[model samples]
Target chain A: MIHKSDDPVIRCDGVWKIFGARASEALDAVRSKGLSKEEIRDRYDCVVGVCDASFDVGRGEIFCIMGLSGSGKSTLIRHINRLIEPTAGSIYIEGQDVNALSARELRRTRAEKIGMVFQNMALMPHRTVLENVAFSQEVRGHDVRERTQTALRAIRAVELNGWEDKYPDELSGGMQQRVGLARAIAADPAILLMDEPFSALDPLIRRQLQDKFMSLSAEMKKTTLFITHDLDEAIRIGDRIAIMKDGVLVQIGTPEDIVTNPADDYVADFVAGISKLDLISAGKIMEPIDAYTRRDGPIDFDAWPEAHPNQSLDQLVDLSIATQHPIVVKLDGRPLGVVTKNALLRGIKGDTAPAASAA
Target chain B: MDEDTTFNILDPFSSIDLGIADSAGGIKQWAIANRDLIQPIKAVFNDIVTAIDGALNAVPPLVMLALITLIAWQAAGRRTAILVGLCLFALGLLDPNAWSLAMTTLAIVISAVTACFVIGLPLGILAAKSDGFERLLRPVLDLMQTIPAFVYLVPVVMLVGIGNVSGVIVTIVFALPPLIRLTSLGIRGVNPSVVEAARAFGASPRQILLKVELPLATPTILAGVNQTIMLSLSMVVIASMISVKGLGNEVLRAMGRLDAGKAIVGGLGIVILAVVLDRISQGMGQSGRERGQRHWWQSGPVGLAWRLTRARNETTPPVSAAPRTEVQSN
Candidate 1:
C-alpha cells in the first residue's frame, strides 16, 4: 500500500481520544487486557472520539477529512495542531512529536508551524479586520510595525484591500471568512488547518471562496488539512480525501479512488450518487505520455512537457485540455507513450488502454 | 445638656405666629356671634352625608354586586376587579369616612414621594458616574434608609419642629431609597454590548447612558418609583404622630378616646387611599412599559422643565450658523 512518494510533512499514529471520567483506566484496560467495547462502555462510561485513527498528510496536499457532524473529523484535525490534547496517540509535524511539547512549545509550534481557521471565524469582535489579521503575529511578540505591515499584505493577498478598517460585524459572512483566512496566513505558518470554514456561508459565496482557496493554495503550496462535511467540496479541494464514520477512519484515497473503489459499504454509500466518470480524470488512469514520439505538425510541447509517470490521470487530462493536443506523457523526461483525446476520454470513463501504458 | 440646648427650637419662631393667640382669645366671642353660621354649616354637612347615604341606599345589593363585578373585570381581569369591588363595598359599609380620609392621605403621600423621585434620580445618576462621589454619598443614603422615621424626627423637630414639612421630610427619608437604588441599578444594568457599540463609534459615557442604558432600564426603574410611592403611603400614619394633620391623627384621636368606630373609619380611609394610589401608579407603570418611549416629557416635571429650557435655547439661531450661511453665500 506504500505509494512512491516523499515523506509526509505530517503524521498521526494510533490516535485514541476517549472522553469521560475513567478514560485513562478504560484506555489501559483496552490496551493491556483487551477489554471489549461493551465492557469499556460499562466500566468507564466513555466516548471514543478518535479511536486508533492514523493518517499521513503529504507536503502541499489539501488533505480533507469528510464526515458528518460529531464524526471526529474536527477532533482529528485538531490533534495534528494540538489544539486539543489526544488521550493516547502521537502526531508528528515536520519530524517533531507535537504531544511531547510543553504548553509554551505547543503554542510556539502553533504560532510558527501551524495556522488554524475555525468554522465560526472566531475573529475577536473588539478588533477591526486589520487587527484580527495581525493577532497571531502580535501574539508571537512581533513589533507593531512589523505585524501591521504583514497584516496589510496578508489582507491584500486575501482580496480584502478596502476592509482593513471595518470591524468583523460590519463585514458580510463571506468577507469575515476571508478575514479568518488572512489571519491564519498572516504569520506565514507552514501548515493550515481549516475546520468547515465555508459551511456557514451562502452557496454562491462558498463556491467563490472555494475557488479562491484552491488558487491561493496552488500559489502558496502550504500543506493543508481541511475538515468539511460537504462531499462535493471535499472532491473539489482535497488532493486526498479521508472518510471517517463514528470516530473511525473508514477510507483514505484520492477522490477518484474513493468514487471508483470505495473501501467498504460505508464509503460506497457515501460515493453512491456521485458520477464517477466526471470525477475521475485522465491523469488518474493514464500511463505517462511519450515525449519523444513522432507526431503531426507542432507537437504541442507544453501538453506532455516532461512530467513524472505518476502524475495523476486528472492532471494529464487537465494538461491535455490546456494544451489542446495529443499528450506525450513522459516518465523522467523519457517518452513513455502518447495519449490522445480519445485515450484520455476513455481513461476518464474508467477504460483500460494498453497503448497509454507507462514506459 | 445645657439650658439653651434644652430650649425648644420653635421658641424663636413663636413671634411669627400672628393669628393663633388672638384667635384662641376671641373663640368665645366669635362662637356667640357665629352661632347662626354654625347651624347652616352643620346643615350643609348633614345634607352631604345624607346625599352619600341616599346614594348608597339607592343602589340595590344586586347593583353593588354588579359594580364589584365590573371592578374585578377591569383591575387584573373580570374576576379580580369584581372581587376588589365587593371588598371596597364591604369596606365602605364598615366605615363611611374611610374613603375620604384614605383619598386625602394618599394624595399627600404621593405628592411627597413624587418630590423625592424628582430630586433623587439625578443625584443617583451623578453618583453612579463618579466613583469617589458615589462612595462619599453611599454611607449617607444607607443611614437615611436604615434609620427609623422617628429618628429623623429628632433632627427634624430640632430644625422645623413637628408639622407637614417635618412629615414630608421623614416620608422623603423612608421613600428615597428605591429611587436611588433603582436609578443606580438601571444605570449599571445597561447592556454592555450596546454600550460598547456606542463607545466603539466614539459616543461619550453620558451619551451612552442617556441614549442606551437609561431608556432600556426605564420600566424597571419606574417599578422602583412605584415601590417608593407605596412606601411613602405606608409612612403617612407614622408621619401623623408628629402633629401632621391627616387620617393618622384621626386614628390617633380615636385611639386616645378608645373609640372603635372612629379608629376603624380612619384605618379604612388609609386603606382606600392605599388601594387607589396603588392602582393609579401601577397603571402608569404598565402604560410606560406599553409605550416604551423614553421621551423626556413622560418622566415628570423635571424632565419637562429640562425639555422646555432645551427648546427655548434651541429657538435662538447660532452665531456659527449665521457665519456658515454667509460663507456659503459668498
Candidate 2:
C-alpha cells in the first residue's frame, strides 16, 4: 500500500469536538451561521473545543500549536494522540485511522509509537524517576533490565543522569521536565507529543530545556507536535507554527512568514509589539557580496557577526545601511552569504530577496 | 370459706390449677430429653476446673512472671514493653500460677481478633464499592456490635453448648464492626488523582486494587485491626462465663473464693497484655505510614521488571515493521 510522503505523523482533519446535549443540532445551527465565534457560542451550549480544525505534522518536524488558554491548542494536540476523541471527522495516526482502533490497539499504539509529556509533568508520584521513564515499556510488558537500560539512555539524553532513584517530588521543576522528556523518549516513539511541557518551569530553565529539546529532536529526527501559549517559545522551537483562536486554526506558517505577513489582523496584532529584528533570519536577509562592496581588511568569512534568528528585519536593514558594506551571513562562524542594504530592505518590506547563488 | 370452694382448691379441679400442673410435667419431660445435649456443657465446666487446677499445680509463680515480661517486651516498644513486663512480673510475684491462665486468655483474645480482621476486610472493600451492599450490611453489623456480650451466651449455650468455640464466636461478633467500618473508610478515602493516574497507566481493576488502593489504605486498615484486637480483649471476661478457660476464669475463681489479691493480679495481667498488643500494632501502623512516603522499593522492583520486559521487546523484533506513516491533511 502506497503512503503519501506529506502524510502527518498525526493528522486531525476537519475535526469537531462539541461538548453538549443536542450537539449535532447545535453544530448544524453553528454551521448555518457560517460558524462564526459568537453564533457557535450562542446557538449550542457547545464549547467547540476544536472547531473544524485541520492540520498535519510531517515526519521529523517540530510542529507547534499555539493559542491563549482555552483556545483549543491543547485540545488540537490531544486529538492527534487521541487522548480526547473528536466528536466529528477523522484522525489518522501513522496512516491508520485512530478512531477505528480498538481500545487495546489504541493503548498499544500510544505505548509503542507515541509518547506524551503533560503540562504538569504527570509523573506518577508513587514511581521514581526510572520507573516513570520506563512506565510505557512496563505496561507493554518489557522486562526490567532492558527497560531500565532504555530509561537510563533516555535520562542521559535529557541530561538527567544519576537522578534515577529520586522520586518526581524530589526533583525541581526543570529536573522534573527532563524526567518527563526522558519518559516520553524512553520507548523510542515515532511521534512525541508535548502539551506545554515547559510552561510550568522558570523562564530560564524553560529556555534551557527548549534548547536541549531542539538539539535532541535534531539528533533523533522524530516527528514532534507541541502545544503552548508562548509565542516566543513557538518561534524558538517550532519548525512550523499554527496559531489557534477560539478553537479555529487561524494560520500555519514558518516563523519568518508569520512575522512578515500575518494571515489576519489578530495574528498581526499578536506579533505587533515583538521586535522585528527578533523575527528576521540571516537566510532571509543574506545577499551576494558584489564588486561594488568595499573590502574591509580582507572580509573574514570566519568572523561574521551573530544575531538572534528572531531579530527584526528593520534592525538588519539599518545595520546593513550603517555598515555601508555587505554584511556577512554566518551561523556559528561558517559563512553562508552576505546581507546588503537592498536585500535587507526587501526582507523588511515582506518582499523576496533577489536570488543570488550561494558561494 | 365455703366447703365447695375449699375442696376445689385442694383437689386441683380449677382450670388455672390444671394448666400449671401440665406445664410442670412438660418441663420435666423436656429436661429429660435434653440430657444428652447438656453433657458437653457439663464437660466444659469440668475442663475449666481441671485446667485451672493444672495451671495452679504445674507452673511456678516466677515463670508466669517471666513469660508475661517476654510477651510485653515483644509486642510494645522498648519503653512501654519494659513497663508492661515489669508490671506482669509484679503480678506473678503475687501469684505465679495465675499468670499462665492470664497469658492463655490473652492468646485466645488475640486469635479471635485476628479471625475478625480476616472476615471483615474483604467485607469492607465490598461495602465501599457497592452502596447497596453497605446499606444492607449496616443494620446487621449494628445489631452484632450493640447486642451485649452476655446475651450471646444464652444462644451459644443452646447451640454449641458452652466452650472455646462459642466464646470465640461471640468475641468475633463483638469485635468485627470496627474492622469493617475502618477498612471501608480507608478504601473510599484513597486519592482520586492517584486512581486516575493508575487508570491512565492502563492498570486493570485488579491491578488498581493491589497497586494503588490497597497500599494507600493500609495504614487505616491496620488501625481497624488494632481496634478489633482491643474489643476482643474486652470480651475475655464475658467469655469465661461460658467455661472458656483463661485469665477471666482465674479471676472469676478468685472472686468466688474471695481472694482479692489474686483477682487484682489476674486483672492486671489482662491489662498488661492489652497494652503490649496495642502498642505493637500501633507501631506497625506508624512504620507503614513512614514507608508509604518513600518510593524506593516501588521504583526498585517495578523499574527492574519494566527493564526486563523492554529487553525482551528488543530481542524479538517487531513483526509489523512498517515505517509508521504520518497522516496528512489537505
Candidate 3:
C-alpha cells in the first residue's frame, strides 16, 4: 500500500502556524526561548495551531494524521493547500515551495495539483451534485462540455450517477460526502487533502466510504494527506500514520510501528482503544526459524500450520487455534520465521517484545 | 457664573453653538460645485424612471393587469397571481385615476429598488469581505435607518432638485440600508467550510462569490430585495411632497384640498399596490428556495410552451418522427 518516492509529492519542513496578531513575535519566542504552548498563549496571547510539523507524503501514499479534537491535525493539513498559511517554515508540493509561489501560481497549484475534501462535506448547497463535482474544473475555466464529462465520470466513480442533478441539501450526509469526494477527484489533482472527510458520518457509512476512497485512491494512485481523529480509521487505510498532539507530531510510522511502539503516553492512549489483531502482521511478530530451532529441537515445517509472512495477527490467531504447534511464516514456500503462541500472545497485547526481538 | 448660582450640568457649554449650519452650507456648496458629475448620474436615474413609466403606460390598463398577474403566476404561484389580479382590478374600479397613478408609482419604486441594489450590493459584498468595511458601514447603515426620512428630505430636494430622479434618490437613501445589511448577513451566513472548500479547490475570489457564495446567498439576498421593494413603495408616496408623479401625488393633492373621499380612494389604491407588490416579491424570495428543484423546461412561460408542444408531439402519429429526424439531419 505504501508508494515510496525519492521526491515526495508533499513535504512540510518545520511549518508553524500560530493564531492571533502576535504570532510572529510568539514564533520568535518559541524558537529562541523554546516557549511552551501555554507560556506562548499567556505571554503573547497567541495559540500555537501547528508547531514545527514536518512530514513527507510519497507519491500515491495515504498519509493519515490522527489526533483528538484540538490536536492541530486539521491545521497541519490546511498548510498543504495554503488555506491557512504557515506562520513560518516551508511546504513544498512536487518540490515547488508552496509559500514561495505567487498568488496566481498558488491558485494554479491548487487547481492543477491538489484537491481537498472537508469533514462537513462543504458542497455548495445551491449547486447540483454534478456542478459541485465539476466545481474545480469549472473554476479553472474548462469548457462546459469537457468539465461535464469529467464530472459525470467522477460522479459515476463515486456511484452517484443518478443523483448528479440533485442539490447537496437533497442528499443524505453520506451521499453528500460522496459528492465531496467526487468533486475532489474530478479535478484529477495529483494530491488529495482530506480533512476528516468521513468523520462526520455514521460508523457503517464511514467504513463504506473509507473502503470506497481506498479503492478509488489505489486505482487512481492519488497521494493523499488524510486528517482524522479516529485512530482506527488511520490504521485502517493509512500507508503511514502521523499522530499529532497539541500542535506537534509525536509519532510517524506504519500502522504496525505505531501500535507496537507508541512514542509516548498520548499516542499509546490513543492507540489503546484500537484493535491490533488486524494491524499487526505475522511477519512483525515472527521469530526467525533458526532462532526457534536454536532454542528448541529441530522443527518439522510440515507439522506446524503454515501461513504467509504478510498474514495478519487476526488470521494467525485462527491458524494458531487450529493447531497445537507454532505457525511457519513463509514467503513463496520458503519459510522465513515461526510465530509461537508466546509471540502471538505478546503481539495481541500490543507488546513490542516479539517485534523488538524479531528486529 | 451659572454653575455657581444654579446646579446646571451643562451650564458652561450651553451658550456655545456647534458649527452645524456651517457644515450644512459646506455640503450644499460641494454639491453645487459637483453639478457636472451629478448631472450625468441624475440623467441616468431620470432615464430609468422615464423608460419604465413609458413602457408601463404603453400597455393598456387591462393588459398590464393581466401581464403582472401572469408574472406573479410564474414567479410565485396560482393563489398569489389571483390575489394580484383581484387587487389591481379592485383598484381600477375604486378610483378612475388609480390605474395611471399606480403605474407611475410602480415606475418610481422599480427605479429606486434598482438604485438600491446598484449602490448596496457592492457595499454589502465589501462589508462581508472585510471587518473594517463592515465596522464603518455599520454606523452609516444605522444612521440611514434611524434618521427620519423627512430629516434628509429637504437636503435631498435642494441638492438633486425636485423631480422623479430626486424622488428615486430619496427612496434609495431610505430603502438601501436593509438591502445592504441583509446582503452582508446573507453572504456572511454562507457556510464557512463551503467557502473554504471553494478556496481549497482554487476558486478565485470572484469565482467563489459568483459560483458558490452568491448562489447560496440568493434566497437571503432575494429577501433583502423584497424588503427594498417594500421600502421603496412606502417612500414613493412621501416622495410626492417633492413633486414626483405617482399615486403619492394623487393622495397629496387630495389631502391638500382636504378631499377626504378622494384621499381615501388614493390611500386604498396605495394599499392595494403595496399588498400585490409585497406578495409578489415575497413569493419570488420563497421560490428562490425551490430554484434547483425543477427542470429549466418545467417552470416559466417557456415551460408552458414546452409542455404544450411536448403534449402535441406525444399525441401525434409516428409519422411525425420522420419529420423530427429530417429536421435534425438538416
Candidate 4:
C-alpha cells in the first residue's frame, strides 16, 4: 500500500519452466527450433512445464490462470514465489527483478511481499488454527504479541475467530481451507499466489468459499494469481483471465475479451459453455449511431431505452425487451452506437461483430 | 611338512589356534589398563548407569508400582493399567525380593533408553536431513541391529569389566538401532506438501525442522522409543551374564541350579515389564502430541477419572469439542 507506483505488482517475461536434467538446453532448443511439447519431451526427456509464459498483473487485480492438468498453470505461479526456479526468463515484482535476487533476498521477498495458499491446505497437524495462521509472521521473526494479533485479525477476516484453537483434523475441509487462507493473509502481503485453493472442497463449500474469497479480495485489493481448471470460476472471479494449454499461454484477456473475441478455436471451445449474460456488452454489438440517425428520421434521444457501452448482454436484452425502438449504447453518456433487435440477437449468437445490421 | 601346508586347518602356524581365552584375556587386561584411554570412557558410562540406577531404586516399590500403573492407564487405557498392576503384583508375590530385583532392572533399562534418545535423536535428524548421511547410516544400522546380542557384550566387558555398568553399555549398544532407524524414517516420512507449504511461507530450514518436521514425526519417534525399551528389556537377562544384578541374575542362577520355578518367575517378570512399557509408550504415540484443546476437566488422571466415573454431565461441553463449522449445510 505504501509504494503506489503504476508499475504492475507482478511481471514475468518469457518465463520458462522446463523440468528435466537438461532443461536449459531444452529451453534453448525450444526457443531456437520452436520444438513442440511432445517433441521436446520425446527428444530430451524433458517435460515443458511452462513454455515462455509472459504476463503482467495489475496492482489490485485478480488474474486467474485457467487450464486443465499438465497445463503448467501451477508451475507458472510457483516461479513468482521462487518455490520452483525457472529454467529461463526474468520475473519482476514491483520493478525488482525476482530472478536476480539472492537466496536470502528471495526468502525475504517471499516472507515479506508475497503470500500463498494451496489446494492441499497443509495446515500443520500439531499447530492450532491460530498458530498455523501465524506461520508466515513467525517465519519473518515477528514477536509473539504482534504475530498473534495479526494472526487473529486474519482469522477474523476468514470468519474463523472461534475456531482458532482447534486442530486441523477437528475442522471440516472448508474450514481447513479457511485456515489456509487465514495463514496466507496473516502477513498481509502485497501479492498472493493461490493454487487451486478450493478445488478439494465439496461443491457447496467450494462455492461458499469462492464467495468468501471474492469479498475478501475486494476488501484487501491484493494482487492475486489465481490458478483454476474451471472456466466458469475463472470468468466469475478473474478481472482478466489467462488460458494455458500444453505449457503454453494460449491467450490472455479480460473475461469479456476472451468470451466475446476468442483468440482461437481452443479458447472459443474452452469458453463455449460460459453464459454470454455478463460478458457480451452493448458496446461490442452496437452499430454506427450516425448512419442509423441519418437513415431514420429525427429521433428523440430521451424517447427510446438507452444503455451504457459496458452494459452486459443481459442488460441489453432487458432494454431490447422494454422498448419497440432500438437501444442506444452510450459511452460516457454520449451516444456512440445503436443496438437494434437483430443486431443484438446476432451479437448474442455470433462471435463476429454483429454479422448484419438491423433496419 | 610341506612349506605351504600351514594353510591346512590343523596346521599350527597361526592356524586352528585355540588361543581364544589368552587373546580375550590379554585384550581385557590391556583395556582395563586404559591402553587406549578406554577405562576413562568406561568410567563415564558407569556414572550414567549409577545415576539412573540410584533414581530408579530411590522410590519405594509400592509408589513406583502405583506410578507406573497410573501412567499406563492414562497413556494407554484401563486394560493396560489393570494388566500392569496384576503382573507387578504377581512378580512381588513370586520372589521374596522381586520388587528390589525389578527395580534394579528398571534402572538399567531407563538409563539405556535415555542414552539411546540422547545419541540417536540427533543422528536420526542428521540422517533424515542429509541423503549422504542417510545412505551411510543404513548399513551401519543394519549391522548394529543384526549383530548377535552376545557379541556386543564381549567387547563391552573387555573395556568396562563385568559389572552393572558394562551390562548397561552392552544393552545400550544392542538397543540403539531401533531409535536411530525409526526416527530417521519418521522424519523423512513427513508430508512433502506440508514441507513445501512451510517453504512457501519463507520458513528457514531450522524453523521448518522444528515447526513442521519434528511435531509430525513425534508419533513415529515414540514408536522407536518403545521398540528400544523392549529390546533393552530382552537384553537385560543376557546383560546379567556379566553380573549386572537384576531379575536376569535370578534367571541365570536358576538355569545353573536347574530351578525351573525361579526361571519361570524371572522370565514372567521380564515379560510383564515389557508389555507394560510397550503398551504405555505405544498408546502415547497413538494419542499423539498434546494439541488443539485444553479442557478444564482434562487435567490428567484426577480429572479424567472424575469425568469418566461421574454421571455424564450434559451441560457445557469442553471448549475444544465445540462445533467447528459455521457454514450452513443447506
Global lDDT of each candidate: 0.71, 0.74, 0.86, 0.85
Worst 10 residues of 1 chain B by lDDT: B321-330
User: How good is model 4 by TM-score?
Assistant: 0.88
TM-score of each: 0.47, 0.66, 0.91, 0.88
Can you write out model 1's per-residue Cα lDDT over B139-237, one digit (the tens) per residue? 988898888786556555554445665677788888887888778777777656445423322234464576566766666677778788878877877
Tens-digit per-residue lDDT, A25-59, candidate 3: 99999999999999999999999999899899998
DockQ of 3: 0.77
DockQ, model 2, C-alpha based: 0.14
Q: Name model 1 segments beyond 4 Å from true.
A: A1-7, A32-43, A277-279, A282-359, B1-330
Clashing residue pairs in candidate 4 (N, C-alpha, C atoms within 3 angstroms): none
Q: How should the candidates be ordered by TM-score, best one leading?
A: 3, 4, 2, 1
Q: Which one is best on TM-score?
A: 3
Model 2 reproduced share of reference interface contacts: 0.11
Model 2 TM-score (2 dp): 0.66
Off by over 4 Å in 4: A1-4, A102-104, A291-304, A331-334, A350-352, A355-359, B1-36, B77-79, B288-299, B302-330
Task: Please report, as a residue range, the 10-residue window in candidate 3 chain A with the lowest summed lDDT.
Answer: A350-359
Residue by residue across B1-330, what tens digits does model 4's lDDT show? 345545766656664556777877786667657635766776787787777778777888788889988887777667878888887777778778777888888888898898899999999999998999989988998988888877767767777678877887788788988898889999999999999999988888898899999888988999999999999999988999999988898899999999999999888888877877888888778652242224323434755776575436546565445433433222
lDDT, model 2, position B213: 82
lDDT of 2: 0.74
Each candidate's fnat, listed in order, reads 0.00, 0.11, 0.89, 0.76
Which is superior by lDDT, 1 or 3? 3
